[model samples]
Target: MNREDFWEIVERSRAEVGDTRDAASAAAVARHVVARLTALGPSTAVEFQHFYEALNEESYRWDLWAAAYLMRSGCSDDGFDYFRGWLVAQGRVVWEQAVADPDSLAAVGVDPDDDMVDCEAMVAAAGDAHATSTGDREAFWAALEQTEGDDEPAAPADPAGEDFDFDDDEQMRARLPRLAAVYRPVQ
Candidate 1:
């Protein structure tokens, strides 16, 4: 599946189910995606993983980090994952704009000052997609039920986490002046 195809799956799933925050809703989407992708085999899995990775990388920006920080009152390590999924589900325009310049998100209504942009449905849908692609049936459902604020096990680990320096709030603020203006760093 290509990026557009992956997005179609997500959109269709969301359209059908409306919300994916609960395990039942997420699992329903997971079943739909898994059933649809089953015919294509592992290539579909690889494509989903690749698309998800690129989306993850795209979100590794100061502006988006600041938006996530303000939205969550300080984003946790796992919160970044949900944020990336949320970014992807914002659809092509927002995704492309954010990738090109994270500041563009402000124009797209992702202002750091507004903390009500809930991305739980998007996050759950992406988790379901990952579950379908990887054949990890239980993990996604279990993740949906989890209440400990831990990172959901949507996909397997990628060792490239060492590449970003998200911990440096000062540097992020320097990079995103607009976000800095609207959001005070949460100590």
Candidate 2:
């Protein structure tokens, strides 16, 4: 599935998730996405996995990580992974903005009091959907490999772009002035 299709699924899930975008609500979104994927059938569910991984790969950047670090006060490697999942749950507009200009995220708004900017369920949604639809997740992966070869997006050795010390307050403020103004002070 292309990004447009992926976003449609995500947004549809968000609609199911209703008005709140908090972590508590994210599980429902994942459930909705799984139901939607199951309805779409197994092949598209597998395609959704590839597209989800590609979007995650596309978003694996130092700048975005910095944004995550600031939003959550500190971000570990796995924390960033979950952050990417949450970012995906935010739908195309927020995800694209975070990738293109993470500072733009300040305008998108988040609850500073709510630090659960992680959606573990979303990370597992496609696989769960595949299993729910096909009864065996490995069978779907094998089918994908047989039909199109292994084209899963790989995680980079490190995030793309210049690395920096996220714990340094000065660097955080300078790198993400708007976000620092919003979340850093709150933290």
What's model 2's TM-score? 0.90
lDDT of 2: 0.84
Task: Summarize candidate 2's per-residue lDDT along 1-187 as a digit string, tens digits.
Answer: 7878989999999987775357777777888898999899888888888788788889989999999988877889888988888888888888898899999988866887778888888888888888888899787778556655465444688889989998888898899989988987745
Total clashing residue pairs per candidate? 0, 0
lDDT (10s digit) by residue, model 1, range 40-69: 454554455556666676566555665566
What is each predicted model's overall lDDT from 0 to 1? Answer: 0.56, 0.84
Candidate 1 local accuracy as lDDT? 0.56
Output the lDDT of residue 110, model 1.
46
Error of 2 at 95 (Å): 0.6
